[model samples]
Target: MERENAPVGPGDVVALVDGSFFMHRTYHLAASGDPARNLRPSDGFPNGAIRKFCERLLGFLEAGFGGTRPSHLGIFFDHSRRSHRSELFPGYKANRPEPPADLEALKPLFRDAVRAFGYGCIEAENYEADDLIATYATAASARGAHVLMVGSDKDLLQLVGPTVFAFDFEYGVPGRSGYRPARLFDAAAVAAAWEGTPPERLGDVLALMGDQTDNVPGVPGIGMKTAAKLVAEYGDLETLLANADAIKQPGRRDALLAHAETARLSRRLVELERNAPMPVPLDDLLLGWPDPDVLFPFVNAMEFSWLGRKLGQLYQVEASSYPSDPRFAAPVAGSGAAGLQALRYDAVLPAEGAPPFASDTAHCAVSAMPLSMAHIDGWLRFDFRSPDLRAEPGQGHEGWKIHVSVDPGRVAAAWDAILPIVAEARLQAKVAGPALAGRLGDSSHRQAGKMLVLYAETAPDVGRWRAVLTRVEEALDKAGVTPGPRVAGDR
Candidate 1:
């Protein structure tokens, strides 16, 4: 039979994902079960594999449609071992090993990561995700939408047809290696390899052979080639059993006749349950890029360093808002009061014998990278007056300007503490600025006093400065240092 060209058109495509099975395979291969390496401290389990799997999945989705937007998509996962398949076979997947303890602990993190991408995860008790996919794939095909069942599982091939196709996201075209789309078990293709019998009869073929992988015991000595031959000659296990004596090989024939009942049971086990109950609707599977805020945090936590840049690009394209760049003024070399090339962005206190105007002599040095300047807000400065200076009848004007700089490493910590205060102040300025102006507040406090001058060009991006100020205030409060009256200015 001639192969058809790849499906074309920009029509709606629904991806019925097998999350649990894929994740199980990935986690087994990737996650190192070391508790110390786990990012989430609450649960001491590591999820390195899940993180990698998610990144790959994201990459696949982004590249699959040649950058064309997908129409509908939803992920389905198996709940647990109490599935109906287990009930039917009693030994279904029982041979599989339990997940590592660390992996088991990271299950919630994996679930959260998937949900963060805005994909719904469905897992019903006692029903496998494969069953749900089969049911949904059939339902979706009936609705006139193309269905792409994303998985490596062969059982899914049974659901493939004109509208439904199974893509093995494991082996396909070069870059599209993971996407394998095949029409439901090609009868003609299987027959060419198996010598006349179609793939639809593979269940019957397997029943006679017994799948050792699934631990089902077929007639003891009969192997795959013999099984395929018998099914091809006799049409099916039932027909082959009726004419058991017609078998050419005495030993293989005796094995088939003696274990005929076992073959029938294995066939039943291999058939997919097409009528499984699935509540997911085709309309509910709206697909698009993931939300940035939700997606980035998980990406960061997972330590997907390479994906961070990709995420930033995707976010810029999808988000309504963009991060702004901070502007900085040119710095004057060796011009600070201390003759230092770099000046700290902070507040300074006045000292004895210091000229009231001496603080103005202190120079502000700007950063070459304006974005970096926004991080150094709330630096302190101190001016000292001469000992001979008097309070009431002040005489001496001798003083030293003390410039305080904050630790760059602690900027984020400081910013986190102070952001709420700055936000609150901004809100107040918006809501009660006029009301406060008319209330006759302390005029002296607002006049020529030592003020914290933030040299960053963009005040809105100065979150780190605000945070530093918060930390400084907390330290001052603890140290019993009463801050003198001051003003704040931003350039």
Candidate 2:
């Protein structure tokens, strides 16, 4: 496939997607309904992941970054599941079970779908999608083109710098009608997410606090906050380990001394390989107008009427012209925000005793303060004019959270009492932290009282949290729950 237009030059946005990450996530969490029901009409092939992947990519391309469409795009998949990380540490990602057989069978179709859109479908042997994304991002950055790394993987955050950013596309939770809003993270967002440990030093934090998902042996007992704190204090992992003997905390000192080599290995495992050999030069990835000749046929075969409408909008034509497979039933709604009936908004806030959020303009600019993530406290979640759209057991959603510690003493009363308050406040004021906790897990109730600590995402809008709190307080006056003293510096 050839691009019909000129390739992107300097200052164009190059969007690189982590294909394997998206495919598996879509197959498991984003694609609605059963895989059996979403098979391609031409053949009995499962095309749920393929359809959702294309839908999201199209949505992203339409949405663009800061009102600019991506000049180039690459969907890079893992050449194989195993990567150099596994070779460096045998136990790497051993904790993960095998990808579903049905999902694995659909990889080739995903690649074909990418090609149909006239975008680069790339993969290199023994390299993970992260490495490829890192490499392309680095190359794109060096060329003076901005890089947008798509996917929810934290490992990719290390690539966020002056001209590079990461975007986590929002998707509907499994078994839910509402969708999570997409989030864009820049250097400040990365620092906010990683407890003020700069994006470049996130590897040090990850090294100290091993990733259970990847089975990296970060020093045991070291969590994200502790690791971030240590890295912030010591500058890096090596410095922290070298000065372990002078550490005041006995347990931490002992863990660093005991797992010095293990921590080093974890760092290596978590670090991205930015120098992978690309099968095609960066110019080859530049996107042109989507060929209706190729795209229409694929969507037609799959009976993607909703996708057809989106494509029609993209091509500036009547959506009715596109044909769908008569046998397959079309989705009840169209694609993107307008098609979805409900929106689930969730965000992190700055908790009490934390410094104000700071925005970073070098990467991307947003108004917000950095809330402290010093500890995990019990969370308070409520609905916003929608049915409970929680995920099924063991399913994963975006990890973005709005941290507020509900009073344990008032847990019973506050649980049901805050529903209407949250819903109304969110609707009237348009605060961005109104969503159900998709899956509940273990949380601490240590400061379970009138105190409400709002922990924001790395860099979050301070006014959003403040507005929500003001509305919640006004509503609370008429309800059972009592508002605690507001945090200092809170408007």
Candidate 3:
């Protein structure tokens, strides 16, 4: 969520997943035929279901989650068969068969997998993930965050609007074997899919057609084409029912007139309850770096070596491998990127006029060191003059995004250290005037002096330097990487 006055910028990204749909899709599609036949873990449990889900989920993650690289990611599961829709109509989804044993068995593992990736999971007793996904998507859209509903379920199509898109990760590009490309569906795509009827009328279209899968009884003998035409002409089911007698064809008009209530019931069944209460804060769902501990072991056990390889590259810390490296042995030889070995580096603030201890000084000057953290005490110090700026492809030259680390325990301490430096930068920027200062949201400020200045947590507050400590704290908890104990909490 955002502040009441937040302006809708390019907006942050969020992905809402439909867990129930994934379970069945992955279980059946991972293998050639048998549901139980696929890669099994060391424990001999069938993992095809989970494996397929992982592969598809990774595509979303790898693609920066439909190119938004969502800061908050969520997967929602339906724990119960009953839902508000089913309660309203007992025959809702009555024709659907029981889920496959293998698919049903993978729910717990799926939940664990989602968590292992530093993402949140949601569940409700009498609400389907579909409804919850729609709720979150709608809320995110209204709040000005771009939402990607990561599922192929048709029910989600209606939710596609400004700030809310349906990214069907399982969509096949056709004739491209082993190449299921993720397709981004906007309002235009939704309208096109239903043949000229916009997403707003999806419920009405479905109501008249009557979802045979869900056993929703529409007016008898009204086919999909007929229903779509009626919805397009009438705007909605209620309008269509009210003006049924106007239809040129008496047969279809009579059917609509006779079963007006049935059409009404069907529309209610497909309509998404976008206001359903969410179980967790929407902000907490942003995807962060997955925990290496949980991710690596889980992938290995699932026999997803491909994913393991990617994680290994992305998460590798060479410091563990380069003990007594020659680069460290001689400062003269360690200045270049060729022999650069990542070591667990820590630099405490030295006393004024004190010499920098006899060790590597000029080595590896050019780098993009994530402000992973800083503090009030001299425990850590960063020099703004020698920032290691690196170009991130497609991210443009937003140097402010240079900081990536989140240390929960010492947010206060970090701010304390940054306050004076940031304050001086602000003052200098003001003295230089807006013409000299770089942009700060809608205004301009002297940014050169404030190289160390950071962004605020919300959009309205962006470009303004303030503590986003809560977001940082939540990020730590999500990554399972807690910061060390602080002096205040130590006692």
Candidate 4:
């Protein structure tokens, strides 16, 4: 996190991200075969929002967008099931259903992007992403640093000011005839968007308008225009309510009187928390380019071959292999699968009783410390219908493929190229784990030729190793994989 001789204050741009805000958008894009539209790998795995976020964020850091790059970046994720606002008002944001299955599945990858880039992730047990963004924005502005809140959550508009801004690239990009462009809003811009009400009163204005999405009932029958007009006149909800008797329209006046409590509650709900227990220090969140070791492997595993290659170029590393490499093969997923979900399969059998790994078995789960290349250890449990798996039920795998490259990085990439093709009888591997850990401890590394195949009888519920591993299990759907005929006791 240390930046020697780094400039602070005025020119320092800190972008605070709302990770959960993008989950809904990912749900829609993930339905596509190529979320990034970068060559359409068609592997049937769609982490659309994750790919979009990681790539765009990487480009932003690379100064691909027209702006001086941010000097500090903090990606705030909402991990708490409910925030303090939800606790105070049981119905706050209760109208929203549980996050979609795909979105929930890709949540880890979202955080993985931040860590892979050597960025700090702020997650609180009782606060939402908006609150953490606000807390960071306030902290940055206090230090004279320019702050950009990277989300379109309207409730966050209240935090807009001279040193703090809101950037909604997702929606703004669509506004530009569907080109991906970043939209930044300062105090004046926030005011313009809210009908001349200053940023300070955005919460108040929303309090009067009533957010149907949040189930916050504002004054009855008062629409957005009237709410803006009322806020412009009275400056805030308390003042507007204090002088409700002076209002001219009979219905508006009656609604204001009747729903004063609701207005106050909505204001409280809409207000951004300028102070919350920060999950990490501001200094720790100081931004930098992606860490090559971590970034390369992750983007490769996520199947963002374009970004992975871009990162390889940026970091001066070799990640992709030549198409003609004997070890590398096209994804073997069944017809009509999204490219990201595709993994190359090989019939390599390991010495008996090998431990789990990200790319060692038919269904593998990998995890390591957040961004560290530390003791990279996780187990793989094989679910073989028999001691051996085959394309045809009574036969054996055609043969084993053994690959070796001198450099650990290249070898890992080469192995990654050959390990994930599990859709056929040859037994493809669906890799789901902490794919970010790179240059794993070589001493503990299992050679590509020695990976164990876990037959169903010997495959333990390795899910017990970690809670995250259980969720990782969700990534490999039985339906997603070409279900081979199960021969009970075949092991």
Candidate topping TM-score: 4
Quote the positional error of residue 170 for candidate 2 in Å: 2.5
- lDDT per residue (tens digit) for residues 1-491 in model 1: 11112232336777787887667767755644553443323322244566566775685557753333346776777665446667767787778766554454345445666766767666555677888888777777777778877776656665666667665544345557455443333344445545455556766766777766566666788777888788877788789888997788899778877888877777777777778766545566676567665666666555554666677776654222333111101111111225331222222212323322223221221221111234522223221112221122345322322112223233223333332332222210011011122221243433222322222212232323333344347543434445433333311
Would you estimate the TM-scores of all the predictions? 0.54, 0.61, 0.59, 0.64
lDDT of 3 by residue, 1-491 (tens): 21112232256777788877777777667755575456453334566667777776676577755456765678887755667887889988878887653453354567667755756768765688889998888778877788889878787888888778888764545688776766888999987778777777887888888888778887799877788888888878888788889998989988888899888888888888888878767766756566665566566656565666666677774222322222112222112224322311223323444443322233322122122124211122222111222112363223332232223333334333333332222111101112111221122222222212242222322212222333333334544653432222111
Query: How much lDDT does each candidate structure score?
Result: 0.52, 0.63, 0.57, 0.58
For every candidate, C-alpha RMSD to the true structure in Å: 21.1, 22.7, 19.2, 14.0
Per-residue lDDT of model 2, residues 1-491, tens digit only: 46644455587899898878877877775355775657656454456677887876676567765455788888887776467887898888888887664564455556666766777778776788899899989888987888899888999999899899999766666568866667798999999878897889999999889888889889999999999989989999898889999999999999999999999999999999999979767888777767777777767766666787778877897555655422122221112223122222122233545554433221111222222234522233222211222222354333323333343344334333333333322221112111112111113222223232323333443423443454345435545666432323333
Structure candidate 3, residue pairs in collision: 64-69, 71-286, 71-287, 72-285, 72-286, 73-285, 73-286, 376-413, 437-445, 437-446
Q: What local lDDT score does residue 65 receive in model 4, on the 0 to 100 scale? A: 26
Ten-residue stretch with the least lDDT total in model 1 = 426-435
Whole-structure CA lDDT of model 3: 0.57
Q: Tens-digit lDDT track for model 4 on 1-491? A: 33323445777888887767765565465555454452335444555566777766776677622365678777777754567888779998788877654455455556666766777766776688888899888988998998888877898888888888888764434546756556678888887878888888888888888898878877788878889998888877888899999998899999989989988988888887888988677866667665565666666666777676777776677776422221112222322234224332222222234433333332322222222235633322222122233234444442322112223223223333333222211232222122221322243444322222222212332211122322322232322322122322232
List candidate 3 stretches off by more than 4 Å.
Answer: 1-10, 33-37, 41-43, 65-68, 170-173, 176-182, 300-303, 317-491
Model 2: which ten-residue window has the lowest total lDDT?
Answer: 433-442
